[model samples]
Target: MTVGASVKQTLANLKGAQGTLRTYSIKVQDESARSIYAEALMTTNKVIDDLNKRLKTIELEEPQYRAY
Candidate 1:
């Protein structure tokens, strides 16, 4: 679809990935593996936040993309 819809979908996918990483972090027994998952989860969270800000900017700059 449209750019807005595509970005929203990508955001959703990233959130899903974050959830999976969190679950893995909780379940894994190895200390190094847990640390790696935690780091990945943190990075994913940062990307999600940045993407959310970008989405807001996009909505503001392109009115047609708002609320979708």
Candidate 2:
């Protein structure tokens, strides 16, 4: 697979992980566990944002093709 495709796949996986973390945080009764999950969620979100920015940069740097 190409770098772009790999990055996109990673972004999707990270988003899924973030959603799972959020759900776990809400369901867990232990305060510590909740806090840990929340922290993880925050980190995952940051990573996702970074990946998106990088993807945008990559898209801008790569050439586009058009068929006339």
Candidate 3:
């Protein structure tokens, strides 16, 4: 696929993951579940980092297609 499409998909995936993380955070907060919260936070952070790296690579390759 093209760089733009790839970047869009990656960003969508990252947003979905962020939503999931937020949900998990709320759940953990309400239930006072530290273990689950920590796990979710770690996973969320990793996904975010990967997404950022991929986005940077895409931007470097195609500087004209900026993501909002």
Residue lDDT tens for model 2, 1-68: 65776888899888988888899999999999999999998899889989999888777776352111
List TM-score per model, in order. 0.92, 0.89, 0.54
Ranking by lDDT: 1, 2, 3
Write the residue-wise lDDT of candidate 3 on 1-68 in tens digits.
77767767876887787777777777665555756776777887787787778877877888877766
* Candidate 3 wrong stretches, greater than 4 Å: 1-32
Q: Name the candidate that leads on TM-score.
A: 1
**Candidate 1 residues 1-68, lDDT tens each?**
76777888899999998998999999999999999999999899899999999888877888886664
lDDT of 3: 0.74
What's the true lDDT of residue 29 in model 2? 99
Residue 8 C-alpha lDDT in model 3: 73
Alpha-carbon runs more than 4 Å astray in model 2? 65-68
Model 3 residue pairs with clashes: none
Ranking by TM-score: 1, 2, 3
